[model samples]
Target: MDSKNRAKWACFGEIFEAVAQQGIDELDAVEALLAALRNGLRAYGYRRQFTFNESGKVERLPRDIYPQPVPVAIWRDSGTPKGDLTSIWQDDPEEPEVWISIDWVSGAVESLDWELTNFEHLRTDFSAIRIPRKEADHLLSDLAGRPKKRAGRPLGPSSPWEKEQVAAALRMIDGGDTRPATAIATGLTDTALIGKALESQQRRLTWGIKTALTGNAKNSANNKRD
Candidate 1:
């Protein structure tokens, strides 16, 4: 677990400790503790659907509202740096957060980095959303919250995976940010994350990004036909 998880779970102890120790004096600690306690009560809840039967009685529907999570082949490419995200999706916050991700080498979600939130629920429930990696890349890019490009110049990212933040940094430049300032803000010089801007590396990154975009588009077209 990461520091964020540890911090979140720590909220549970805030309330009991407040009274048992005769009240927590630290303001931030008190707030986090209280917030954690409140979250615990509401966080695990999920929506339940109801259906009206022929007899006019409201019947409780089965708990599995969605289809099981489908395991898919993880996209792999040397482009975009190591540990750079290949895929990401919105998680059901109500479910315990699992950073479930594809393990490309094994073609399995079961890996050291990620896990299914509820394997049983997935096995019995949740539908498949098989968007190709191409479309997925575009969708993921949008989800990352990039702004639309302006007319004068297209601000293509240095790395294929540099979606939202790159755009944000570009905006800073358009608003009169110096190279040094932009570099500092966006890690423009952060070669450590990706690598040196070599032409071959760029080609590979471009291909990966294109593959993701095309795959997502193909999935959408197929869905329409269905």
Candidate 2:
């Protein structure tokens, strides 16, 4: 290992030890390790490309120009359920001269290894970093329960027309109108935006109804006692 790599490994070791000392769960430790690796690689002028194999179909995830932390659920979903998962970081998108590979089996990290190809002689004898697993099954279950992030350009600021439509839909919903009826009346075809606007209102309406029912039951009990 070169002096630069030795320094990087030392930094990683410090981070790993700090995370382990925090008494965090296995999944948290794994996430911390990944974050450390990504940050270190970014400092080393590496561009990261994420990909996963799902049901034997390999698909590359959207490339990130910035070093944004990817969610663990997305990583878990990239592989077959209860199967192996791998993430790679390379210095180049077309042809990477240096790269790091991390492999996981059912939410437990199996190996984290890196290689440098620019040397006069190929160097592939780096030892892998192994993290012991105590709650692999639990980790997998938790990851499965977490929602995966939708891959696409996020909706920008709502236009004035959209705001007006959402307001009209909410008003109709408040007046006991069904969502479809509100949509038809307001001419707002965006069901998703309407639903999002109504989410808090619906929750509050449900809570209010429950409270009213409970109050009625209490009044009836008082009347019986009287």
Candidate 3:
């Protein structure tokens, strides 16, 4: 190869190596930061309360720490129940660690993994909460109870998005929006459902009993005169 071409190839290889190293460094930094946060949250005892196991019947944790009040199960199969919290690397081969978020207020009972955001105080912020393997498995099993329904039309009669639109329309009706049925049938969520309904109601389309009576009286008087 020409010297110019050889030099270009060497530069490309060096660039690739640097990019790879940067990616690795980023992952390592994430891991280290989360590890420190999780340890601090646990040490503070904010989320160290005993909780009831819903899946396996009601049972308290054996080594419960918080004594004043036992930890209550935040959710059942209905809503998104609390799951194992952890800071796991995306490239990690092992399963995610089960952890809990300790609320600073009670120091007992765990919170959801998502409550921690960058908006909170860094030193006082929740880092991570690790749950035991058994608890993690139980939470996972509970989450898997209901099968996720498909979003788009999957050989079914109606799609989930369609259902959501209809539901939104009904909500508009309940809110006293006089949106026309035709507009609602169009299946626009924010626009047709809410906006159209609001516009329809602004014109006072629904005839009030008093207004109807007054109109009839005026017509009757005109007919008598004629």
Candidate 4:
């Protein structure tokens, strides 16, 4: 066997061994294998297709449609035709075609096939796959809302009010309140401040400072009662 085929079978063997170790039934085994294959294809930028028959006409349905008709066959494709260069079809002369025929009622994979030719195209460089412009923009927008890490020593509570705020936030957190709720109670709108309060609370517990503070509070209360 060629190196490519050998590698493919070896990977399949590993998946089979893992599924066998779980001691599942035949149906479960088939489902697990299907899931693994679908996930692997998605990771390589393959898009799914749902084929449906309506009134004697076959149609491709979008993923979000409700009451999804069981697909006669599942198809995944990736190539420059769709502005994606993440699949083997990027080098193929014809359009991409990879599909798995399914028996939905019996929950069995009927057949699996793909279009390929033996023309010596260079091996795919997955790391160098170019992202579509729209996807790249979306990723950038998502990252814009996240906090950026700063270099050098981390900053702590800079003022007495800030220290008190952190303490109040920590108390709310200890009461099992979520960060958003704690933020509202403590008037801490900045998520970074909420994070700092959690860190401070952890440090106090680690250093036994919480115990000391509790003891001091109890002694003050006793003195007042005296």
Q: Give the top-scoring candidate (lDDT).
A: 2
Residue 28 displacement (Å), model 2: 7.0
> Local error of candidate 4 at 11, Å?
1.3
Which candidate, 3 or 4, has the higher TM-score? Answer: 4
Candidate 1: where are CA atoms >4 Å away?
1-197
Q: Could you tell me every candidate's TM-score relative to the true structure?
A: 0.16, 0.20, 0.15, 0.22
Ranking by lDDT: 2, 4, 1, 3
lDDT tens digits, residue span 17-53, model 2: 4434555454454563454333432212112432223
Candidate 1 structure quality by residue, lDDT tens digits, 63-166 = 74532333222122111212322223324537543333422212223211232453322211111222233332333334335575557422344454554444
- For candidate 1, give the lDDT: 0.35
lDDT of each: 0.35, 0.39, 0.34, 0.36
Clashes of each: 13, 0, 11, 0
Error of 2 at 73 (Å): 24
- Which segments of candidate 2 are over 4 A away from where they belong? 1-84, 106-118, 125-129, 132-226
TM-score of 3: 0.15
- Clashing residue pairs in candidate 2, if any? none
Query: Distance (Å) between predicted and true CA of 23, model 2?
Result: 20
Which candidate, 1 or 3, has the higher TM-score? Answer: 1
Candidate 4 per-residue C-alpha lDDT over 95-119 given as tens digits, one digit per residue, 9 for 90 to 100: 5233233322222222224324532
